[model samples]
Target: MLQLVDFIARNRFFLVFVLLEIFSGWLIVRSNSYWGATYFNTSNYYVAKTLAFSNSAREYTRLGEINSDLANENARLNALVATLSQKNAKDAPVGYVPDSAFNARFTYKVAKVVDNETNRTNNYITIDKGSADGIEPDMGVISATGVVGKVRFCSKNYSIVTSILHPQFMVSSKLIRSNEIGTAKWPGKDPNFVDMVDVSRYTKVYKGDSAVTSNVNAVFPPGIMVGKVKSVTVHPDQTFYNIVLELATDFRNLSYVYVVKNRQLGEQETLKQRLGDRR
Candidate 1:
């Protein structure tokens, strides 16, 4: 206690000077209009900045919820648009200028890809949908950008899809510009590219030509876009054109996809079968 008193006695003069200086500064600022205005302005700037940061943080926290709601709304609107287009097309007469049927056939049933594989020779995707969700084998699976594959198997709550990159996967696709059709197949070499065979050599073919499903087979509807022609190679001895296609869908980065359900699929197939039997 005696030592502390000695130290305080020695620093008493300096401490008093510091206190007086601080008091003088405060008095000067309070008395001067410009100083007071400057201090308040600086304080307000900091206060406003802090408030803005706080509000931004709050908004950032709610962004996920907002984004989810927007995505749902977009999907709903797209479905409505598709339904209206289909109705309009069906009502149109035989000679009417038909809107490209591709846009109408793509009905989306959004499902998350729970599991996916691209490196394997027999790559497959597992989605969080099943028979209970109206998903069945041969149902066309696609994303907003383009085609993914077809449903191969389904359980009550889950489904497996055969990717277009698979060796067994074959889709009937045609050139969008010329309507020259071919069989799209994967060579099990490149995941990004597929081979389109049986395109006639006489047809005008070029790179960057869009390829879409022919829908001749009952598996997928006509007009679902498959890919774009990346390269075309014509063998001197071969009669058909061999074209390489760049797939529209990025299989490696697949996340959400839709399983298409055709309401009139059964009836259409039944009528075709009866006609075939009679023929």
Candidate 2:
């Protein structure tokens, strides 16, 4: 206490000067409109800047949560769009429907690709949805841009996807211009390219031809984009066309995907079995 008193006594002259300076400034601002206006303007400027900084800080902290919410909303909208598209396709006249049966074969459920890989030979992806979310094995997966892959396995909260880059992945795809369908396969060479085989050379295929799911095998819905023709070559001795397709989706950057579920899958399977039994 005695030390504190001595310190204060020592600094009393400086403290008094500081207080006097503050009082003089206040008096000048209060008595003069010009000074008051100047002071107010400076104060207001600092206050506005501080408030803006504070608000920005708060918003920055909330960015992740906001992004997640937005992604979920986007997924919901995609699901609604898929549903509506399916309904419209089904309502069309039966005679108008294509004979391929791929156009109306599957339904879609939206999911986010929480984890993805592309550089490996057997690349796989993990989605933030599972069987509990109506995902199932063999369900076709796609994004807004194009087809992704199919669900391989699922748990309650997550699922593993067999990426289109996987060697085991095979999709029934066809040229949009010529309607020449073939088996789409990945040769483990490029993540951006897939091989479309069994297409006859006489199909009139060329570079830049759009390819889509054939839906003939009922694995994926027809019209789901597979890729575009990047190159076409006829095998020396074979009658088939060796076509290279450039995938529409950037596999390394996949963020969101939709798992296609055929609501009538069970009925379709049962009918197939019955037909086989009769045969």
Candidate 3:
């Protein structure tokens, strides 16, 4: 306390000058209309800037939560679309469109893709969801753009997805223009393209044909977009055309995915199991 008093005593003249300067500035601003306006305008500008910076920082920290809410909302929309489509499918023109996909009842779950591999030979995706979240093996995973993959395995809090780029990965897809069914497979070199094999040369495939999932099994709902036919090639001896598809889902930008749960899948599997046992 003695030292503080001595130090203040020594700087008394400077301290008084600083206080007088502050008081003079305040008096000028208060007495002069122009100065008061300018002072308040400047202070308000800085105050607004400060508030904006602080608000931006707060919002930046909540990005993860915002993304999660968006994912959940997307899931709800997907489920709602599935339900509504099934009810309205019968009104469509007969034979022009397949109604099986729309008929399927699906439950949607939002999942964040924690890890994704595109360059690897057997590319797999890891997601931040698992059995604990009602995710399980064989559940189809899809992005907002298109089909992603199916769940391969799951732990209590995480799951691995079999990427469409995997060599063994195949989704039954049909060219929309020609309605030709083919197996969409990745041959393990380029991640951007998938091969649509088993399509008969006479199927009348063409460039720009959109390929979508077909009603093969309960894995994926029919009509989910797979890709577009980039090229269609045929060799002299080949029975099937080498149809190249530009994948709709960009694996490099994969961040969030929706897991599809078919409400009727369990019943279908149970029936198949009983039939197999009888055989």
Candidate 4:
């Protein structure tokens, strides 16, 4: 307290000057319209800028949560659409009601990608869902834009996906325009592209043609986008075109994904096993 008194005594003159300056500025602002307007405008500008910066910061922190919500919403909508489309099919069983007759073949479970890798020869992604959440090893994984991978392994609360970027990962795909079937495989090189092999050269494929999951696949439902063809070239020694595709899902930017649970997969597998035994 004594030291503060001594310091104030020493700076008394300077403190008085500062106080007077502040008073004078306040008077000018209060008495003069121009100064008052300038003061208010300056304060408003700073306040608005501060608020905007704060809001942006808050939003940045919530990006993951926001993405997860959107993914789940999309999953719900997609599942509903699939159900309705099937129900309205002309070949749907007689006496089919949209509610009772509709079988939920595929349902999506939203999950956050806890880990992702795209720079390796065989990349994989880990999600924060597992058997407890109905995630299974063979379930298909997809992003909002398109296919990501398939669940390779799972625990009670987490799962690892063999990313579509993996060399060993293959998806049965077909050209959207020509309906020519092919196999989508990563060439063990570029992270931005996948190769659609076994597409015959005679197929009506073009540079910008799209490849999508075939309806016949048990994992992904029909028409899930795989990629757009970046290049299509005829190799000299092969009857198939060397086609490259720009992957629909950007693995580097992936935050949320949906695991496709095909409810009939087990039934299909069991039937297939029985048929194989007969053969």
* RMSD for each of the candidates: 5.9, 4.6, 3.4, 3.1
Order of candidates by TM-score, top first? 4, 3, 1, 2
* lDDT per residue as tens, model 3, 1-279: 999999999999999999999999999998999999999999999999999999999999999999989988988887776666555654357665545654547888999899999999999999999999999899999998889999999999999999999988899998888988889999898999999999999768889989988857477767788999999899999999999999999999988999999877888899999999999
Which residue pairs show backbone clashes in model 4? Answer: none
Q: After superposition, how far is residue 240 of candidate 3 from its true place, in Å?
A: 3.3
Which pairs of residues collide in model 2? 102-215, 102-222
Error of 2 at 219 (Å): 4.2
**How well is each residue in 164-249 modelled by candidate 1, as lDDT tens digits?**
88999999897878878899999998889999999999889978999987746556655667889999899899899889999998
Candidate 4 ranges beyond 4 A from true positions: 84-103, 235-237
Highest TM-score: give the candidate number: 4
Clashes of each: 0, 2, 0, 0
Better of 3 and 4 by TM-score: 4
Q: lDDT by residue for model 2 over 1-279, one digit each (tens)?
A: 999999999999999999999999999999999999999999999999999999999999998788667766765665565455555664367666443333344556667789998989998999999867877888888887788988888999999999999999999997888878898889999999999999998769979999988747555666778899999988679899889999988888787787877766777889999999999
Each candidate structure's TM-score, on Cα atoms with residue i matched to residue i, is 0.73, 0.73, 0.84, 0.86
Clashes of 1: 0
Candidate 4 RMSD to the real structure:
3.1
Tens-digit lDDT track of model 4 for 196-219: 999898768978988988867889
